[model samples]
Target: MTNDDLQFTDDRPITTQAQDLLDRAGFAQRLALAVSSWKNQESLVISLTGGWGSGKTSIKNMTLDHLAAVQGCQVIEFNPWQWAGQDSLSSAFFAEISRVIQREDPSDDDRKLAKLLRSYSRRLNTGASLADGTAKLLPILLASTLATSLLGTLAQGAVAQITWLGVAGASALGSLSLILQRSGAWLGRWAGNLDEDAKDSALTLSQLREKLQKLLSTRDKPLLVVLDDLDRLSAEQMKGIFQLVKAHMDFANVVFLLLFQRETVEQGLWKAGFDGADYLEKIIQVPFSVPAIASSQLENLLFKRLDEILAQEPQLQQRFEQDYWSRVFQRGMRPFFSNLRHVYRYSSTLAFHCRLLRGTEVAEVNAVDLFALECLRIFAPETYTELSKHKALLTGSDPYSRQDEPQRVRTTQLMDQLVSLAPVPHQAATRQLLQEMFPTLDWVFNNTNYDQGIQLRWLVNSRVCCDEVFDRYFEMSIPEQDVPNSLLHELGRRITEPEPFTILLTSQAEDRQAEILQRLIGLVEEFPLDQSVEVVRTLLHAGERVGRKISFTNWSPRQQVTRLLRIYLQRFEQEADRSQSVINAFALTPGLVVVEQLLGADHALRRKGDVGYFDDSGLEQLKSVYMRKLREKADSDPDAFLADGDQASYLYDLNSYSEGGDEGRRWVEANVTSPDRFLQFAQGQVSVRTTHCGGTTTRTSYIPVSSLESFLGLERWTQWAARLDSLELAEDQCRTLALVKEALAQSEQSVTAEESNR
Candidate 1:
């Protein structure tokens, strides 16, 4: 898939005209008809309730769309959650109704009704009705009495001779006068001119409500007001909306439609101190619960989109296996998608990251395994994150690499904790999925272990369970110094073409070259049968140059290339075929170092009592051919042959195997006439020594005195050891000589200690 195909789903509600994947369109239409045909003059409050993300909004939008065709009906939508305070909610609700009336119905009486509605909303917000005024008047009088008593006590403290009772009586009279002046009817009876404006203001709320009801009753069409996202509001705000609908705004010819999650609203209402179910039942004249989407329909929708995404990647299709995918999908991926939003989210995540992986071919991941991991990534993000951090524990790569009894028990506990991060219902399925991907976990779950051979196959396929490729699954990109499997796969295809194959190897960075060669070595087993000889030839040629400089303490580029040859040889069924293929590649190959290493592996295997693809006679023939080739190269250009950095060890091996150790020493002595030659000779003699200190193990490369004596004899070795510091030696030669002298000193001390002990 290309980057252009990478897009994320925003989880937007499906448009009213768009095709409904959840099969709720029919119910929405029927509900719309019921709403539009309602003949009741009293305000009808209809509620559409469901759980969050259960497509309540979509069904509501669709029902409104269907209601649009009704001639005598008008719709007004207000999102109460957008307003923070109760006063704002009440004002915005009435403003929305007034806006609909002014925009849709331009009649003078309807305009007057809209103005009355706004005034009524303002009066309700201000708590200015007669009942509210009377209810608040008693509290004012009580507060006034308490303030006067406190003032009287303070005045007596100022005037020491003043009587507290007499002061309190005068203060009470002043408070009563202020109350009468403010109220005019309750306290202003003796106050002058109880104003007409004050009286009119007191009755304005009742007048507005009666006029609004009369005007709404005369209207031909009912106004349907939709209050959506009610469940998203705070308890107080949501309760205010309910109060505004049930008690305050119950005007004739006006229907209120409330959209929210039932359980959420109920809990919020309960938190506000009331029986939520009873309050909702009293407010709602008609309640409609959103229908539950069918699981099969959701599954079909999810798979159809997944298939569309899969179709963009042909390589993914080729790698896709039906049986394994079916098992993983049913057990692992299927459980995560219960609703339409879940499906969209998973599909978007898969598409976006799959595009990234496809563009890079970072891990050569199996498409099905990637799908399962994405299921965890979306549904169980914590588990996915834990998997990335605990790669060794999950892949069994480290201390738990071998599943002994103790390790198994420990790993089982860790695995149980890991799987428990998923939802409770999905824990079992997630564990099973992990087992299917990582066979190392099988022992913990199934009391069995897969053959170790299968892990090599997993590496070949770039399965995530393979420790080397595990990071790519989580990282979604390649790490530094790692080679792309796409390039390695291309190398396999280009094995027949020497120039392109060489170019591909040369294109990689020096550090990445080793990784590329290593991955190519792993892929050798899967190279086509017809390209076996050519593949072997190409790898040996590449190895001579690519593998020459890459050396670890225990592994050499020579061993790496030889391993590639050996794995490729296994494709041949008969021993004769393997021998013939090796001989054929050696004949076609140009490098002496890689061929010698390949034959050296065979000789070593034979010494270990294994046939090693070449029986006794065939091994001798290949060695003879190798010796002849080496002699020809040496005879043709001795300087170039000696200048070759990696040839020293191979030459020593040839001389020792064909002739004897004495002849090998004579040849080495003759060749070591210059400092450069001696450096090359010393570099070849370098042996890696491993030492463990504290908890760390380290490998140090140094030439040993005993090993030097075996190649150079006692007298010649002594001559070189005596003048080691005097000569102008290179860094590597100097280091080697220092190591040899150190070894000699340690050996002498050891011998003396042994004699003393005896």
Candidate 2:
């Protein structure tokens, strides 16, 4: 989808039935009816239990929405998470109920109820604790109504940041000490009148409870207090909340609604040295598990989102294969999603990646395969991360030669680990999906093998099974050094049109020219035989213009183009057809070096008596066509021919193709008239060799006397040496000329020795 049409789905709980993707409205409506129909005088506590992200909050909100029309029902939502890591959870609970009661225009009864709540809280805060026969001070800073007010002011002002930690750090040491001293004085006074204070406090609290019960009993509407996300609170906070509910459970015409993930709440309570499940059973009068969303419903919602996104790109929709998607979705994706939250998460992540990759050449990736891979990215992130680093292991073919059993064993172990990252129940499905996407792993899992012939089809179709385009799928864009397949296709289509084709080929940067040529070598393998004649001719023309700039490595632009031509020519099975394609290419374009290199491969194969593309006669005819062109170029502009970028290889080919090196030596002798020209000629005569030393290989270039003698006769070489020696040269020039003369003397010694032996 385009950026304008795309949006990430949020994780908010749905408030109305219309917003519900799963069919939970019926259950929510039934719950609302049950709560509204309650006529008992005793307080009711209902617990909505489910796993996290299982739509408990959504169901709760929808139930509240259904109850909004029922008269005389009030909701007080107290999110315990807001007061997390604080000592004010109990104070905050009563304050919320009092605030909601006071929110209505405060009648005398409402004000009286608020006053009774304050008095009861004060008694509880001032009461002495004797748990385990030890006098332990409670967190009294926020227990009373006056103290809660002070806590609110401090939280909104200077100590706001520290309040979240609930007076539990070195930063609050002084403040906590001052608070303890203030409460300690009150405790001391109470201790002085211990018997009297205890008796009076007990009577006063009993009187307050009776008054509060009578006040709540007269109310026409029942009060519903909702406490959600209870499990998100700390362990102490969860215990405090449950303790608060238990202490206040005797009130009349009041209902408490608590929603949480059961396991999280149980774990939190258990950490605080309480039997969590037993603690919950004591507080919660009635419990209802949030209904599980069906697998089909989740898939429907996911597919609906996917269709909306995929509809924006018509080409991707056309490329989507329904059969493969079904296999992957049923076997691989169905296990991970158990709720609407997962569907939204997967859709949002998929939409973001699709937006980045759309309307670009990288969008040519197979849509079904990308969908499955994106699924893995979300559900099995570790596997996705390692998959990027191990492309060769995933996409590489089984070896044709001897097998390395140890390497295969290692690969099998790694593949098992990757599949094991998924949920245990889905591991088999994950393995099946991986094998379907990457057939190379078939050998590891099922002992199935794939040959190298199918690789071209995979590459041409832009499947992830090919290494060339694998990075684009993960990076969401083409890598800088890699050529885009769109550009490759465009070049192939325009190969017959020489001017535009040459411009396109030469327009790439010097650093990327070698890679671009390498990709084209694969692109040419897919070309049809009918177009080979014109395509080869245009490629030769382009290769002449794109001659060897910063591409001096083994796979230079020239070498790549030569390889491309060989693959393109093999499209024609008959030797005559291949020879004619090469002849026609040379007849239209005058590139001598590239044609010579192309035929050289066949010459080696033919000499070894292997099955080659061309016979001796066909090779000679094609050579004669380029040979005539080379002679004309030498005659017309000899300086330009000698100044070619690959002049060394050209001169070598020239001597080897002509009779006894007469024609090539004449051209060289005429060109080597000056000291600089002779130096250039000598420099071009150097032989390159790679030698291994101390576990590393080094390339050394030196002019060999025998090669120079083979190119130019000894008499001519001596004439040039004497001419250079007679001149008064610079220091560097004399050094260079001396090296040449030293090698020439060695050549003379070898000639003398050979003559004496004869």
* RMSD (Å) of each candidate, 1 decimal: 5.8, 10.1
- Which regions of candidate 1 are displaced past 4 Å? 1-6, 84-92, 105-109, 112-148, 154-220, 248-253, 308-324, 361-370, 399-401, 423-437, 473-476, 499-514, 548-554, 615-620, 643-690, 693-758
> Predicted candidate 1: what Cα RMSD to the true structure?
5.8
TM-score of 2: 0.73
Residue by residue across 619-694, what tens digits does model 1's lDDT show?
A: 7777777777776776576567666765556567656666654545666666676656655566666677778899
lDDT of 2 by residue, 1-758 (tens): 35467678887888887787788999998888877776666889999999878999999998899888665377788898887754346655766777888787877888888766755654554443222112333444334434445555667655675673464443256546756765675655445444544543445778878988999888777788899999888888888889888988988888999999999999999999899999899889999999987877888888898998787655466446787678777766777778778788888888777666554433557777788888888877877887888777777733432336776787788779888877776677677778778866666667877654456556655678777778878889877766776677678778787779878888987556667776666566556677776787777877787746442344767677777777777777787888888788778776676787876777778779887777567788887776688778766875676556556666766677777756677778776666677766776665566888999988775568765666567787777778888888878667667667777788888889999999
Our tally of clashes for model 1 stands at 2
Candidate lDDT (C-alpha), each = 0.73, 0.74
Q: In angstroms, give how far residue 489 of model 1 lies from its true place.
A: 3.4
Q: Over the full model, what C-alpha lDDT does candidate 1 score relative to the true structure?
A: 0.73
Error of 1 at 571 (Å): 1.2
